[model samples]
Target: MRRDATSSARARIGAALLLLLSGSVVAAGEGDWPAFGRDPSNGHHSPLTTIDRSNVARLRPTWIFQSGVTGYFQAEPVIVEGVMYVSTTGNHVAALDAKTGRVLWTYTHKARTEKIFGPPSNRGVAVSEGLVFEATMDGRVIALDAKTGRLVWDQEAVRPEEGETETASALAATLGDKPVQGSSRLGFKMPPLVAEGLVIVGVTGAGYGLHVEDEKGGLDGGSVVGIEGGYGRRGWLAAYDAKTGAERWRWYVTKEDGWEGVFAETTPDGIPLNRDIAAEKAAAEKNRDAWKVGGGSLWMTPAYDPALGLIFLGTGNPAPQNFGLTRPGDNLYTMSLVALDVRTGQLRWHFQQVPHEQWGYDVASPPFLVEATTPDGQVKAVAQASKTGFIYLHERTTGRLLARSEPLITHKNLFAPPSPEGTVVSPGPLGAISWHPVAYDAVSNRAFAQVRHGAATYTIKTVPASGNRPELRYTETSEAKGEPTFSTLTAIDLASGKAVWSKKAGSRLSGGTLSTAGGLVFSGEEDGHLDAHDAGTGEILWRFQCGAGIGGPPVTYAVDGRQYVAVAAGGASFTKASGFGTGDALVVFALPD
Candidate 1:
């Protein structure tokens, strides 16, 4: 059954109060990871020190839960009142006993017959007001009874427009090819965010479609291809009444007009954008309606600030992925950290990390909120581990640049444009820091990030379309070729804006970082090993080899006074592309009782 409206409101109020009291935005307690990032702050930090550095080596596998279905298991399990909720690759959600990893119940959404873009993956789920909320691959937000896993309410977040299917079918018939996938490749890969009596979620794939991959079957050096006419879709973030799942308000990532804002010559932080302003302005007149399908997908959950009533989230790359000749001008809101009013969904402010992006550099990671001591004394700020290989710190309220840590990885031809031949760029489209969450330690005023050190060759090609418009098409191929890729854990001091310490790992780091008051930082490797590092220094203190790659963030929670660290160990596309095997286990570690 759905939670009562009054009770839900009260719960939200209580959660807000707890956030203010604890100086944390996540409503998590010492024993629970109730939401992604373990709270609204996206701190990914635990207060429990029982499993501190001194005894982390003694940690052993307490239990393992295997979900028979497997494919990119990136779900970060949320534990509420000792019942853990996890979503599998196929949108199968299961409630498990937090203590023993025993399954309590499971709910699976019916599979979609239509082809879907991107990988079959789910990041995680949200728990609030006695309901477990999940965003399905088919564009549905479902509320399940937390205790029994029974269905409560199923809300169609985005319904296909009338004749939309017929339009695609007719287009396919005209071209004598498969039906052209519309912008509504609508689905939710991100974990849901519940706050202010609203279940907040966003849709992805607006900027994705059929891509031509190399013989290796990897996207690293691939080119995106699409139908002749405007093929991309608009991306949106919305809020719904939690109790009844009714629509509240929606914010489209793409602006109707002026999306090509002022044809800025440089980024907000004064980085040369290498744009052709005059050419973009000339092209803008011909492609005046480009904003209709302007792509700006939201890839992760937002970090909420209760006191400020603002929510912060990062946006994906603009539509058409790498082909920028058609869509000219700075793609406002895309590749940005946007702050919105939680109650009204109104844009408060935004800081674009990249302007007029043509490099496929999406700000894919979640933003972490921290209180840093700036030149103006202590102030609340939000930090994002960017794909550009810098930790960007912004003043939360005013959206001011506080500090940006030095590049955490290699920087070669940072924003070189694609050419007919090819241009090599380090920190390729996969990012120096991908979609994984980073950990913030307030005690040490340091942020820990896992980054990749690799590069890709981008080559551009033009093709002719067969549609009525018959417009010339521009496409780019991204081929992986460079030094052997490796991973690193860098500790950035928020105050000094410098790397305090760094540690390298042999394999790529697919998962995220977890810091605790226990003086430890934890991350998962593509090699299937979870390593514990000293929070202050970058020393590997403990390591555990799971059966498969750990592609999700490591979360720490407690049940019955026993501290436990858990992570989803399933293979990811990056792992497979990098020659690492995958697994399908939820491995829990705890100090031996």
Candidate 2:
């Protein structure tokens, strides 16, 4: 059918307006978890209340699908239509019938067998327009046909450099040159986000491999000598054409120019940074080009605000992680919540939670968008729970601080510098809130965060350059001490910036949390139990043993009118270090069918 030019133009305009409006609305439905935080805002909240507090206790395991590939299972299952998409360890993705947990199809990638950093794990997948997108641990972004699980396209997002390879080999060589120990140590660990016909994903591990200890010495399970050096790669986030795997734009997390930033003595909110600015300035001239390999890995899926046309995400610590003697200054965007233009990949604004971060306090979790009321009035706001044990709220548009919640966990020797003699620091490295996603309940204007309490011995050793070594080096080590580790689930009232209630746990918390209108908050533990708590008050309402530690985020979706809660039950490195059983299962729960 041929149409008039004027009519076609009007139709196009109308469609554009519809899309703009839809983007502005919080359009997440009760029946689907289409993306990693269940929506663009990363709220991790659902409106379904069918299985409220009164009936939540009646919930039981309705279906359990075993992936049979064990390691750290941390993928949060995403549901679109009636199908649930999950990515397992080794970058294996699967589509399952939401109601029955029947495997529809599976697509396994022949990931690189070479040395890699971190574990063979993925956070989750994104579903949009009949396509499923996954960012693999081996540095590839793949799209799959939504229904059939057929490969649509694959693009390599990060290419390994010779320096990175050498670093990986060096780290592994200490462990008897084991191939598994030396696998390519750089890639993506978080899910990919599909937005405005673009697949947005970031790479991690750029700040890794600086120091690795064998478990034989009570590290690496006392199996291998710790290897430490000034070895790391640059980190970046890139956008790709969703339909065609073509690169659109790329943004390096560490900038070449102006990487030092304004060497402010205090943070944006006026907290004393405790930095030796004079010493940093003196060292800047000699290390002018350090930003090239200065690590600032992106480790979480981003949150998008269509109304603002901005995408928000957090970056990891600077390179050499705990040993930041080479890279000085604020480190610009590292350890910050950065907002960028969705289409152009241009920086809009950033709020650095930790400037010149020495504490391994990377902003590892996803930023959540919410409407917050301030002293002036209600405004668009974004919130992120930090490893430093606070939920920071900011005015989304201007990046102004609205408020910061009270510390949810203990904080000791927070900014203490590493000394030759070990210094004990609480909430060391692993964080009060690790990469686990926090759940927000709009009904109560509260954010639920999983908090961990543990201490580590921080020590520094200076290695003098010798015959083969080219330069002097500093090695920083953080060893976990038996100072009684524990966890807490706390609900902070964002409006008031206060913790309404907190519940303590025996083991450190692993996975994330899901708050529903059912007056319940679902979360998992290092142990193999998934528990439901009363939303208003932190009370354990119900619990289930999934046979493995639930070290991934919990999600909820509806099939027809039935409500189901799902989580990946496989032990993670953290859980295993703390002595927990591991398995590979995606367990789904529901009220009596």
Candidate 3:
């Protein structure tokens, strides 16, 4: 359970573990936030500790950089030496002095504006070998000069499948929207994971369905409606040469064979799925070609272990948006934590969280690696935060589940099918940890999650065929009306596998949590406050209002013996109706010298 080490003992253990776990992973320097998740392991814990629990109250804004290009600021800034590289929501890359917030250079990414899936978002960029690389929202990957932000090379990674626009229209019709309002659903939204000289990125929005756009110009608030028919592209994770942008390897999330795999009646953890096995089998035979459009969007940065030569990542929901009767069989690879050969793109092992899932419980969070104690002894483990409200831990080598941390949020009417009248799912599609990364502290044996509180009302609307249209039934899962929403930062004890404490995080949590060696947990709020909590007790130690939704993870680094913390603020592109703020600023904080 818990390896409770303190101070000197903990430091010794953490150092040893870091060295052992550094297989192919970019172990970020103490003063650099070189990679998203702080390092390739996706562990958002910074080793810098200048502004610790003692002086954190004195933390003040040191500088603010405005990118003018505003929207959802989901990209994590990458820093090296004293320079900072940031990819904007519009796929533009800007280089700034990490110390003074001075603009150095800006590289404008020419993104094809049409026929893309979902509204555009460039989650982040990867920097290596003096080059900055980003995966575009329009299905391409490009590399630029790290110092000058000059375009170094550009390569097309993926092209939209033919008839994608028509499919978008058909899916959007359920929500009664304009053609332009239809979601462009196949593109990249995750920061690249550059390791072993290869730039790794994954495709998102491959999971079909018009993710409803609200009046605020965001794809949030409305119900996710699924229509009958096969209209999704296969999702995949690929690796390209960081220098030349040449393709190296590509791994499709859904497998070509054995995808049906006995049509499991329960999840891998033995939770009964209440599956209509017989019906699924019949549908399987009739839809044997469903694998062609099987949606397994990979939208998060994968964690890598150079020692194991394997990279870990979680996959999203299958396409057609959650009506189980459409695509039958176990739908191999989607909604799972999978380990792949970093050099080959071949699947090494997989652990599916929701088999034949209909609840939209995609493994939306990225997996991270940590050293934990098992029955046998100390072992390297990989963990992922699931939309279903648990942090899954598994043995690093075998993919064997070791333990699941306590629930980060409440669950009610789980796995129950949507009734024609409507069924309430406490964690509808917006999971407890909605794509927000969790922060873990090995010394404390705890993990921190920024969780949302709310539920969705799933109503089934069965349509009878009019001429040329077949009878169809689908679930319109919408935000449960009249439900008051809030966010919380919960600390889960890995040793006890229980929630140790939780602090109310504003009206809504805009991003994930970031913990530091300084023993503080930091998270953003929809109300524009970036708060720091005591890592051990979940107490608010300090806070600063960014005045814009802090829509990205908090990152910390050091410059000239001074430690600085930074986060992005922009009103959320989605959820304005929910009261989340928007803007275009990256604020940095530090103690006054």
Candidate whose TM-score is highest: 3
Q: What digit string (tens of lDDT, one per residue) describes model 1 on residues 108-131?
A: 768543455466789999888788
Candidate 2 lDDT (Cα, 0 to 1): 0.78
What tens digits encode model 2's per-residue C-alpha lDDT throughout 232-316? Answer: 6677899988889899999888878898999978777676767888888988888787787777888888888877888899999
Ordered from best to worst lDDT, the candidate numbers read 3, 1, 2
Quantify all predictions' global Cα lDDT against the true fold.
0.78, 0.78, 0.79
lDDT of 3 by residue, 531-563 (tens): 989888888899999978877888888889899
**Model 3 ranges with Cα > 4 A deviation:** 1-27, 160-167, 171-184, 213-219, 482-484
Worst 10 residues of 3 by lDDT: 1-10
Report per-prediction Cα RMSD to one decimal: 5.8, 6.5, 3.1
lDDT value, residue 283 of candidate 1: 79
